[model samples]
Target: MSTTLVQIQVEEKRFRAHQVIDRLALDIRAGEIVSLVGPSGCGKSTLLRIVAGLETDYAGRVLIKGAKPQLHSPEVGFIFQEPRLLPWLSVADNVGFEAGRGGGKHPRVGELLAEVGLAAFADAWPKQLSGGMAQRAAIARGLFTQPALLLLDEPFSAVDAFTRMRLQDLLLSIAAHHGTTLLLVTHDVDEAVYLSDRVVVMNSGPGRIAGDVVVPLPRPRDRRDPALGRARSEVLTLLNGAQQDYHDIAPDIAAAPPAAAPIDWSKLSFAV
Candidate 1:
């Protein structure tokens, strides 16, 4: 079995007494991909922040690869919802951002650009790139450090649907090739189901773990597979249940759960 790579034991995480995560314990194995899904303000991102050592105003322990993670640990890489490229930096320079943070040089900037299909854009300014291209550059930057783990915060949420799917595939491919552990926060149930080895559902009103489920499908997953649909439903059910519990006191907040849309079996194969 793969050894544990991340251990989170957050006793209390709060924003000036507004609790975010409390008594939330989670373990991620090396090379595992875990997605966090829940209603807004459920502390999913907060949990990632704790793991990455970005937020220290909490009471708890977060161990990455058997030790505490530092801000520039070189063991963690992050990609945010926005590309967050520096305007003055060329595409190639942005990709090397992690190298500078590590206080060393990354000799693979060109190789990394080529890997992300940005070889031609090496000299391009951030303003000249499309949303997708900029995001691709961010992806390259995240992987340039070759960290043992990557944390993504709705990295594809800003892109078009088609572009989102492509980025999801790209992320998985990169993780698999690099054997990098991944923890991501996403609001899309389809995305959570498709990209994660396990989907962790959280509840608001102080942010607690409601469910953790394993994805049963094999790799190179077919987005249109009935199996994927079933898995998606399972995760969605968990999310709805968590939300229902959180909103139990407020009947007006209890939403009518959306019905599952049936897929056209014949048209699925043609779906991009």
Candidate 2:
């Protein structure tokens, strides 16, 4: 049997007398892409943060490769919701920051820049690049360490629809090419279905895993594919059911329009 890349066992936590994540258990195998979908404040991001070792004040055991999580370890990479790049640093410098001075720059930094189609802006400062470009740089930086696990917290949520689609494709390609295990937290059901091998639905506040469904879609998925639509609907149903009590606070899943038309891939350029 194959070994698991990461595992969370009975992970529980509370903040200010309120439970955040309770009894959350999950296991991700090597090379798998698992997306966590839930309403806002469902502790999806918090759970991810805990797994990434960004937050240690929590209950339960988080095991990475059968050992405790090490946030600063080079084996894990985290991509936050915002690009969070240094305005003073150039693109290459930002991506290679973690390598430290003379840490033997990441051999894949240039390749990653090309993969995200940011080669032309290698010397550009963060403030000079477009929203998409900055986020791409953030992704490149996260991958510079060649982490075994990549944790993304709505990394593309801040971009335009077109840019979001392009970044999604780029992320999928990069993950597959690197054989990196991924745990993504996103509110967009369609986005989760488009990029994930498995969709793990979480219940609102005092969050816990509600459902674990395999996507079963073919690789190189098109956003408008009928299979993707079905998967989105399934996830929507799960989320809808999970939102019963907090109806007024959650997004209107019932009123959401069907998946938008197929994404335009031609506009998305990548060199790697």
Candidate 3:
């Protein structure tokens, strides 16, 4: 049996007087790839931050391998939406930034850059690299610590569609090679369904788990597979239902979600 790598029991998480998350419990097994999906301001990012120990103001307990999470712990790596690499630092330096500026000289720096296909740009400045390249560097940096769990918040949303697909594939490959557990927050349903072992749908208005869809499909999933399409439909249904529920209860806070069209399995995509 797989060991649980993360255990979260958040009774309440708030911003000032505004509650953002309430009574949420989740467990992620080692080496699992899980994605949190929901509408904007559903506390997805906040939940990720709490897991990373970046937000301790919340009311909850989060455990990483049965231990309390520490701030900036090497066991936890976080990749933000943007690369956030220092403009003055070289690619190698940025990837090894956790070790300080001299990190560029670290041997693992070279290996990570190579793994992310950025070895040639090791000495390149952040400005010299494109958006996708910068994100690639960020991925390398996130893995520099050889973290057991990696958290990403909309990491690929900044890139173009083609680049996003490539990065997704790269992430899958890296996770397989490194056995790193991933917890991701993404608004894109297709991305969540494709990349996750489980899609955890969150409802807004004090975010709570609305549904959990397990993708039993094997690795190397086909993007066009009808099974994936069905999984995506399930997620969309859950999302819409959650939204509608929120809208009914808090009409002033959230607008109702648009009705989703039925899925056409033969097309392997949502029906228009």
Q: Considering every candidate listed, which one attains the maximal lDDT?
A: 3
Identify the superior model by lDDT, candidate 1 or candidate 2: 1
- Residue 40 in candidate 2 has what lDDT? 83
Q: Which digits, one per residue and each the tens of the lDDT, describe model 2 over residues 17-99?
A: 98888899999999999999987888988888888888888878999988888768888999998999988778888998887
Give the C-alpha miss distance for residue 236 in model 2, angstroms. 1.0
Q: Which stretches of candidate 3 lie over 4 Å from their true place?
A: 255-272
Q: Whose lDDT is higher: candidate 2's or candidate 3's?
A: 3
Output the worst ten-in-a-row residue range by lDDT, candidate 2: 245-254
Which RMSD does model 3 reach against the true structure? Answer: 8.4
Instruction: Report the C-alpha lDDT of model 1 over 1-272, residue by residue, as the tens digit.
Output: 99999999999998985877879999999999999999898898888888889998898899997899899778899999999999987788889976665221356888878878888998889999999999999988888878999999999999999999998998888898889999999999899989999999998877999988799788899999998788888888898888887778346656567788997787766536
Assess every candidate by TM-score: 0.89, 0.87, 0.93
Model 1 clash pairs are none
Q: Relative to the true structure, how large is the alpha-carbon lDDT of every model?
A: 0.88, 0.86, 0.94
Give model 3's clash tally: 0
lDDT value for model 2: 0.86
lDDT score for residue 67 of model 1? 91
- Shift of residue 18 alpha carbon in model 2, Å: 1.3
In candidate 3, position 18 carries an lDDT of 89
Residue lDDT tens for model 3, 55-158 = 98877799999998899799999999999999988899999888985898999999999999999998899999999999999999999999999999999999
